[model samples]
Target: MKDNLVDNNAYTYYHTVWQNGDVAPGTHYLDVTANDKFEGIVKVYVTRRYDADNDHVKAFAIAGANDGSEFEKVADVELPNAVKAGKAEAEFTIAEGKSYSKLRFTVTSTTLERGYWHMAEFQLRPMTLNADCKNATYPEAFAAITKALEEANKAVGSVSVEDIAALQNAYDEYKKAINPETGIDAIGVETLRNNAVYDLQGRRVQNIGKGVYIVDGKKIVR
Candidate 1:
């Protein structure tokens, strides 16, 4: 497929045998949700079951298709051959002035072909550039309101654990500090307690072992 500014990569594996299967023996479909797209030079790696003599299909190539019917070759050369059994790493470049959405691998006859080849271990990652981050466009006025809230919070210090239960009051005080005339901010005071100490859902928990209980999403060491 064509490469663009957005770096995306993915993996595909034909674990099932062709010909004997319902689909044809040539092309198969792959899900890209697990792997992302590619932006520039992508490392193509695969592990296959079959090999052709010494010249066995050491490497493979990529073809892009928008509708899955007609296909066009993207890379000129086949990926480097994998001498080992499981993985082969071949670098393929996304050509300039072109972008691709979908790609597939075409398997030519290799030397050792008893059954069809079984392939796996695919990867595509960005090498040239990072993706862009756009600013949130909804709130032109909310920017100033947020800035005032930050300044007011800086004037206040951290709340202690004993007073942690009173965290809801902090939001009210900040709202009042910003708008002295109207106390409406205090009307809808909401408190956010990080229950992750006992729960494990909202935050990313790490360093957990077996037989642990996850509460709310956090791992509780048993």
Candidate 2:
């Protein structure tokens, strides 16, 4: 993917880069795992091959995500004064401590003369994280949580009631163990059982109505 950008090859005829024949809005996704190492900044390169009749991309919105499933908008670029012909490039700095492995670019309201959207190159350059600040503990915990959430999400339709309750209980316990400021575990299971309510999946709740819930990690139907 990195070579495609620096090679100076115009992707006008074929689908070398991401190009669409239709003028409608389209979204393009790119995985930047090879370039991103919890980086702090990302540089984007967009090369336009030809421009006639004022045909060009209007507005583009960029979004990033750690896990490909969910994405958050990172940058919004508007070309009010359309470019005639040339390469358009921009550099975006990520949040102080945040990083993303995947990026999505959506182009909206493009003007096409030949009924095609042309993009010669789309490249990403991510800044490397410092070696001294690298920590594996947080990432391991995050991976475990992500895996649990993925399993919960996959069990939406096929899981049994008991299975759901067990999964929820596990999640609640995990949350309690990780939350340093909450100190939920210090409150004692007996007190939590008396005060808190559990949802059908065994998650603890407050002020819940008539339904299945979990108290002290035990499932109860109310």
Candidate 3:
């Protein structure tokens, strides 16, 4: 069940820093539904990709749902060229200041390369902080995140990526303020759901342990 493909169940947050990439294009229309939801713009990131043409988004559309019912078409968006991280983003606003629980969309790549569309990693999000915090485990900490999210979404004129990133940092800081655990912070929880291999000790093990390890969100014992 694990390969160099994007699995809606397994695909999660990845690094934005330039590094050797494992991104590969799918053979079909790339449609994904976010586990969390936010208002404002949506962005995707592709790192270390060799072809630019394969990264183009053909048709982009968004749907939102608050009650987990059928997602109503909220916007037919036009994408903007990414200012950073070989990314592509679409700006959309939810009506009536609604926060959706299901944010679903379809992204078709403009071109196909050797059956690979080079969608790279859809890794752009400063949205994690915007999830409702009223009933959260750490309401006090997440309230700060909510405030940051509010400023970013309601800002006058256009909100820059830097401004959005500041919100993300606030999310990270508040997560720490709440103190989820003694070890790693909750910020890396998304990164944990990836294709990398790790051993029993929680140490990332590479180029070894072909079996008896975890990769692509699956247990391999071959």
Q: Write the per-residue lDDT of candidate 3 for residues 1-222, one digit (tens) a residue.
A: 212222221122222222233333223333344576556655443332323332444445567777647767777655554422244554556665666776755443333212223343454454334444422556676667667755754453576667656766775687577564733342245445877765422456544411233455443432
lDDT by residue (170-197, candidate 1, tens digit) is: 4334444445334232222221133332
Error of 1 at 140 (Å): 34
Candidate 2 or 1, higher TM-score: 2
Identify the leading candidate in terms of TM-score.
2
Positional deviation of residue 31's Cα in model 1 after best superposition, in angstroms: 7.2
In candidate 3, list every pair of residues with a backbone clash.
none
Q: What does the lDDT read for residue 196 in candidate 3? A: 77
Residue 14's lDDT in candidate 2: 16
The list of candidate 2 runs beyond 4 A from truth reads 1-6, 11-23, 26-33, 50-54, 79-85, 112-117, 127-222
lDDT of 2 by residue, 165-214 (tens): 66566656555555634444444355455667644323455454333445
Worst 10 residues of 1 by lDDT: 1-10
User: Which structure is stronger by lDDT: 2 or 3?
Assistant: 2
Over all chains combined, what TM-score does candidate 1 have? 0.39
**lDDT-based ranking:** 2, 3, 1
Model 3 worst lDDT window (10 residues): 1-10
Lowest lDDT 10-residue stretch of candidate 2? 11-20
